[model samples]
Target: MLERLFESTLWNSRFIVILAVVFGLIGAVILFAVASIDIIVTAKYVVATYLSGTHPENFHQDVIGGIIGAVDLYLIGVVMLLFAFGLYELFISEIDVAKESEHDETQLLAIHSLDQLKDKISKVIVMVLVVGFFQKVGYTQYSGALDMLYLALSITAVSVGLYFLGKVGK
Candidate 1:
């Protein structure tokens, strides 16, 4: 089923990209909305309403703050999820690696091709992971951009590896 998913039309289609963009857009909107909530809530309740003698309960403050914070965090999470799905849609495609493994024979081109592919993939992965770690630590946005590039390159390597196998299979 997992293999089929990578091979599916849904994955290759533009629909997935559109869905991902929408999710990111919604998340951004949520973030923008909640960011102003703090100012508005404090201004209205602490200043304007206070002069009118409408003091709210203290415990309610914590509850409301927590709820708003949670919503903000959830929006960020949703954005990340959508961006990840976008990356998957852009870079990943299916080739039956299992099929390659099951074959009893090997050709020189297959071996060399696989070796080169492995080298390229491993280097790219390590580089991207290192960059991603830095990005996670908030050092730079460039690292995050590089991570997307690496993901695309990794997918291309995989496709090339599969093509090599096809050539050797013949």
Candidate 2:
């Protein structure tokens, strides 16, 4: 009886994962809010600049950079969401509402195994990295032909990696 009680307590300890699920969801919400605010601020900047009839030297680049930064944040938020949902399903219980949803979008959050969760989170992380790479490249100045060639090669590498990433599990 003592051994059975100990085993039962050990198994119930998995509920500790609820802490991670709750915090992960909160983090995702914060990220999404911050990204949305960044987009709004960028829009205001654009409108104010055009209305003033004075275009800063790097106006376009700045706007693009802001948008890209927000996109990066949004992607990270998605990763957090997936992490939360996957953990909850794996350790706690399947989300009943998601299972009953008629929309296909709910399928995206459905995770049956730890490997599937990792793959989903990793894909979003790669996308976030790609966005961050472009955001930095947009602000950088190339000094010579070699620099430009390196940039081209880096872009090609990213593209090829993405192509193979898409092929996985298919």
Candidate 3:
């Protein structure tokens, strides 16, 4: 019994790691794209500013903070994303196992359910983020461009979620 318990604990640890990695890959891909965009935009701005021979006060501060914060957020998101993905996978696994014993077609059904779950979660996050943006802007000033950026990021996240749902669940 002691040996059996040890084995089970070891197995669970490895299983958790595998699940974390699976989701981390997708999360990393998204973060990589975002980081690349930031780098390109910032590089252009920095070069243009230097070339113009004008020192914008506090410009260095924004550039440094932006670079650091962008990476930090992506890293944090990776950790969180992995945990969320593991939970999502556990649910999908449970459905797969439960249906396997009864049905000739379990994968397809499980995939559909998982896809729907992903889309629903993505929509909820987007809604909340948009509402927060509106609240933030309301307290200060409003910018149409902010709205557009929020919309674009939300759509991108949803699209990526859809792709993963099809890959893992289907």
Most accurate candidate by TM-score:
2
Steric clashes per prediction: 0, 0, 0
TM for every model, in the order presented, reads: 0.31, 0.98, 0.35
**Decreasing TM-score order of the candidates:** 2, 3, 1
What lDDT score belongs to each candidate, Candidate 1 first? 0.49, 0.98, 0.58
Give residue 30's lDDT in candidate 1 (0 to 100).
68
lDDT tens digits, residue span 1-170, model 3: 99999998876675655565566667767776786787778788899999999988867755765565455545545444534554545543454464657776443323335455455445444444544443343344336898768767866876686566556534
**Against the true structure, whose lDDT is highest?**
2
| TM accuracy, model 2 | 0.98
Give candidate 2's error at residue 79 in angstroms: 0.2
Q: Which ten residues in a row have the lowest lDDT in candidate 1?
A: 105-114
Which parts of model 3 have CA positions greater than 4 angstroms off? 1-25, 84-170
Give the root-mean-square deviation of each candidate in angstroms: 19.5, 0.7, 14.6
Model 2 pairs whose backbones collide: none
Alpha-carbon deviation at 18 in model 2, angstroms: 0.5
